[model samples]
Target: MSIKIYGDPGSGSLRRITSAAAVMGVEIERVNIDLFKGESHTPEYLELNPHGLSPVMVDGDFVLYESSAINLYLAEKAGSDLAGTTTRERYEILQWMFWSGEQWRVFATLTFDEVLAKRFMGKPADESIVNLAAAKLRAGASVLDAHLAKHDYIVGDRLTLVDFDIAGPFSQNERTKIPLNEFPNLVAWQQRLLETVPAWADTKREVDVRIDTALEAAGIKL
Candidate 1:
């Protein structure tokens, strides 16, 4: 049976899982859970994920929540080196994944929320909020840039689950205004992935379209 993924195409975390599936050539059926319509909070949907988050995965009777874990599981099942072939590699991969979510992504989302998300809702961005978020994002980017200067990918020299986990948010860099101009290595790394990974490029293309459609529906011209 094909794995089923429950999430909106506009969701960054959902995109991460789908991009990994694309890279590994895994077939998946995407089920839309409209956050705006409160579909995720419905009783039936909540049963799959108590937190009511997007991008839950169901492969037969097994259900998985959290994007990073789901991607790891998919990689392992697909026998892709994206999961890491050795224990040390696996731990290091997990380290970057955790850091991606806990340290880096939080600020990225904050900036996106204060800027793009608010703009979509016909709201003005608060300068204080946007500035704070951008500052944090820059600090995180600096660390990532320094690391990336020495390594091609987040965990190691090759593309892995950690790359997908960390780079997913950067797909919104144009819309969210992520400050990466000064980080040449990080910018170059992102460009390399987009150019080399057909799956990621395709997934990001679909995401861009969805974002545009959403913006049009909201009568917001970009």
Candidate 2:
């Protein structure tokens, strides 16, 4: 079974799906879509994904978009322990996945647009908008930090697709200077994730470099 993943480096969606595949011991043929140059908007790419989003997954005749969806699909395909073995476990995994997408992703996108896009891509930055986004982002992190304090992983004791799904956006928060120090549990959780996940550790340096460049361009000192 051949799987293809199209994404730009350092995108949270890319990290989520790729890390999921790695954890499942699945090898995906990567197709790099250059978001830096609007490659995702090209006619050919748009034909594949009308939304023009990165982290598109193509398996045989089936094609899917959205990072969370891709991660779940890979986990299901691989029967990875992360997908959960029971009905309740599956529900918990889905719950955290939804939380990550609805809550964390919204805040991260706002910051990316208000800060990184403005600074690095020469777009306009709205100070009020970013401040609001920062507030919401911190609020969400607080909740996550509280939950993580009691649990080693998002769903129960073992790592699941939930952990992989949330890690991408949460890790990006550090890059955006969201002040994770306020959430000590989250800081420790991220460190533990990096230590346990080989894929995350392998990509850490590259991810940090990319985030640093973007943050620096935005005048956000790490």
Best of the candidates, lDDT: 1
Report every candidate's CA lDDT.
0.85, 0.79
Q: So what's the TM-score on candidate 1? A: 0.92
Off by over 4 Å in 2: 211-222
lDDT of 1 at 201: 83
Among all candidates shown, the one with the greatest TM-score: 1
Model 1 ranges off by over 4 Å: none
**What is candidate 1's lDDT per residue for 11-34, written digit by digit as tens?**
788889988988888889999877
| TM-score for each of the candidates | 0.92, 0.91
Q: In model 2, state the lDDT of residue 90.
A: 88
> What RMSD does model 1 have?
1.7
lDDT of 2 by residue, 8-119 (tens): 7767778877777877899899888767678989998897799988879899999899888888788778878788889999888888888878887777787876766666
